[model samples]
Target: MKTVLVIEDDIGIQKQLKWSLTDYELVFAQDRSSALTQLRRYEPDVVTLDLGLPPDPANASEGLACLNDILSLQPECKVIVITGNTDNEHALKAIALGAYDYYQKPVDADVLNIIIARAFKISDLEAENRALKSANVGNTDIIGNSESILKAYRTVEKIAPTEITTLLLGESGTGKEVFARAIHRQSPRVNKPFVAINCASIPENLLESELFGYEKGAFTGANKTTLGKIECANGGTLLLDEIGDMPLSLQAKMLRFLQERVIERVGGRQELEVDVRVICATHRNLAEMVAEQSFREDLYYRISEITLNIPSLRQRGHDIVIIGKALLHKFNQEFNTQVQGFTDSAMQSMLHYAWPGNIRELQNKLKSAVILADSKYITEEDLGLSARNAKVDTLRKVREVAETQAIRHAYTLATGNLSKTADSLGITRPTLYALIDKYRLHDLRNTETEN
Candidate 1:
């Protein structure tokens, strides 16, 4: 339930306020000291405070101080100020001091409730907007179309229909979270939240509370009750990234959560049943970890009802050019720069280079080149890979890279008409056809023929 704090000193007013807001978990604090304690303890999302208090009942000073403290400590907290009918100026001052809204007395429960409800609605909308932005704003988050990635996507499509526990296997920076989201997007719980937490990022001691949450007084710093990533993702998807690094002790608890679909806060006895789909990703080899007795064997089997392995960019070959072009187009639209195309040297350089950092590194390199390249046609020098030689290149291989990129660039520049793509490259249509055949660039042909 949404929680609200009322910091009014008037006995009759407080009673009416609490009784009116029965839908919320309302907590009352009569004085500044108690109010601050409750503010820290409850961490209520919406708060109603009176400008008059015990120490300074005739003045708005104490109330303004409380507002500043609450705003400073919890910037996201929404504070509504209550003031006497004669204290209109003080109420306006409260608004200047970062108050969410002001209510002038005599207290009208209906009007106040409307304002409070609107504040909560605004809070929820902001949170939802942030999630939408993260999930859909940019392709930079993760990208793939190679068979390996496509295979993983297909697995996600199939597994998302069921509540089966899924394990994603890949090296770091392979966009494991991206694949996890695809599962969430395809799942029955698509409309719900998709919460993710990195197991390896948090400290071992803190990871438990972060995943399952903790009640007030659960730990030294457990000032307020919190819904952990798992609980927060209820009726949706919860992704545990880098689960291989999840401590062995917590592994048992995680197994129990998966088995029962329930979790207990760190120091709370009650079991909270959560209806969430669990998806986990890790770089470590679980089989190897199990063999070494570092990972729980039973837990491994539980989470791995299905597994998808995301391949590195090196394994995908010339798909790098396909992705690079896509990225170039993305940046071209975003930055509104007129980059005609990649130069011959840059195109071959991209084909021959080994992308050790996978697609992420490729993205970073392209973003850098996009910002730095002086010409409409970015060259090998702009990519900063001119010094890196291809590990092994046959004579036919060297010629093939130039011809393939030449055909692709020509096709793209011509908007994919084969005759135009061919003429633009200063080659006869038949010669271009042979080169296209030799290079196995079918997608380019599709576009060319379509145009």
Candidate 2:
């Protein structure tokens, strides 16, 4: 049986909870000392914490200290804090400090049970996704099954066989590197070394040497002869991440490399030919950079034989739930917790929220949620989105401000039949009727409908 550590000072409340969660091995610790002892001995996956411990029951310092100690010992432990009715602000602060879910007193087992279940599910999902315990570790595996991701997969499949220089465009944290790796994985050069270099990270002076490699004595601290990423990727592929920030001089050199398939090592006279496929990616708008003369237009034209745009998480339907489930599983294994899964509300929030930081942010937030969540299902609150005001306002369509191209999607998918377009949206046929009337799309529909 799983263990639950209850940290409330009230004896009556403790007895009630111990009876409520009798299925689990129940342990009680009213103060910091007993709590630490029970925590060390039992190592409970979920803790029902009362933020009013003795030595300062009226103040939150003792309880907060206990919370920190639990986290420090087992950062993945699920700690559901107990707070006052109007102490929601403190609960939010506790969440920010990595508390899973906080409850408002007086304590009610039914409500607390719900929170605990959600926490368990979240913990389970996270445990399922983590690869191993190590620093700088990443889940290099491509992690989406949405139509948008499927489209990306298809694009990679189509371009992988060819030697064309492909440009991947997307917002940061949208898994540009993952897509780049996917392309390499499916390419002809899979057996060869796949080298990746961040073009924008290295200094301009050092960037050249990092890519083209430097000959010994090429520059200060150029201690020994070294092969650059491009040469190292010979007969393979090189992913130029953040390619938009590369210097124009380097862009010119890169264009030459693409054309000649040869690179001159920095400060070296060797003109070595390489058989490496080039894949470039950036979150920046290259067209804007080109117009500003911050980037080489000619180089952009050369490298962009094919372009793949990765969709953001918000655009990927149902993928949020998929990735969340995957993440919950990862944390479950990592922390050895029994977190169940996401609550319906949590799932809805994941679907509706605009993921500004994309997958990376999802992992971090879920990691905290899984360890802190106390229930079998992770509620929206457990995911740090419980505030009623935090609920998202739905994305509304504004035809008046929309582009002709935007409405064209509705029209095309509707098969250019205005009547069908209105039916799909569940609005009154006349409401769709009015939109078609106002948008001047009726004429275009008739012409296309006839065809």
Candidate 3:
């Protein structure tokens, strides 16, 4: 049964509500304190808040405070503020403060019932959507169909079973960790631990101990010996993330461990042998750092036996729209908004934006748009995009670019065969020739024709 909290101090009206709304599991509170208590206890999806409470029944201060508290505690709850007939100001204020909706005084049972039912319906739909997304989004599967991503996957398939140390280079927020996990999953040591540590996030002093462990008396706080990440990941894989930021003082020690396949604990003389496949990832250029003498060249050569360069979101053609659609589904389910998809202008803007943060930035933008959108389709304004001026003038230009991209994609898929390209694009050879001429796509047509 759906839960509803009715926060009205009037005892007579409470009894009437209980009798009328027998279909719902109702919880009632007469004051702000009790209402807050009930909110935490029941965790209702719908709240009927009255903007008048004891000690100041004529004023809305206490009720508004209760509303804020409820919203802060349960942001997804649909709060229907019940205000006096002349208290339109308070109603609007409540809405601005995040109340879902408001009802004027002299509440009819049927009208109130309809409002509460609608709220319940929306909440249930959002809950179902969230459940569905949680099943897929939490997995380590890298989601993209772009050619760059496919090539990266091919590299991963080739290198996963080997014991050589691999290096992954990418722009920040391009799902390097996800790729790392994919490698681990495909490796022979899939059942074993895949330990990961961000070299830059931890303090320099603590980093050595974190990677190589310590003896009981290594430091003042060391009460017992502990295994480090490399030791813990024995017989498995160890991912050293943001390896460019590893302290110079520790680089030689790390290089020694990499060369010898053994680690010496802090303040201990005995060296312990460990079997671990090391995978290093960094957004920074290690080659430049090596030339600058900030990064050890020997260490770079040791770690980068095989290298995979992850493509940025902007470089992955048509992936922006594909990922955007997936995100729209996810956020709509999360926020309980029925946002269908992006508008033509919004899609064009997304295609044009540099997306400095890559997939992470796109996800954030779509999330905000989903929450703020008041229409079925998300527009450029909803996406908070500033480039909304040249919609009509740029339509033809955008179409041409889109057509060119489509031809390129089809050509690549067809392996540059003219007949296959024509068949894939559902166009006659003559029409294909005309398009190729119009767009000057002769380079794509340089391949063999199926005579």
lDDT of 1 by residue, 38-67 (tens): 999888889999988889999988889888
CA shift at 292, candidate 2, in angstroms?
Answer: 0.9
Candidates in descending TM-score order: 3, 2, 1
- The RMSD (Cα, Å) of candidate 3 is 19.2
Candidate 1 worst ten-residue window by lDDT: 131-140
Q: For residues 366-451, could you state the per-residue lDDT of candidate 3 as single tens digits?
A: 99888888889899888877654434444558878998998888888887787788889999988988999999988866775554
lDDT of 3: 0.88
Model 1 RMSD in Å is 27.2
What lDDT score is found at residue 267 in candidate 3? 76
Show model 3 residue runs off by greater than 4 Å.
1-140, 333-337, 387-451
Off by over 4 Å in 2: 1-140, 386-451
User: Ten residues in a row with the worst lDDT in model 2?
Assistant: 131-140
Question: TM-score per candidate, in order?
Answer: 0.55, 0.57, 0.57
Reference-based TM-score, model 1: 0.55
User: Any residue pairs clashing in model 1, and if so which?
Assistant: none
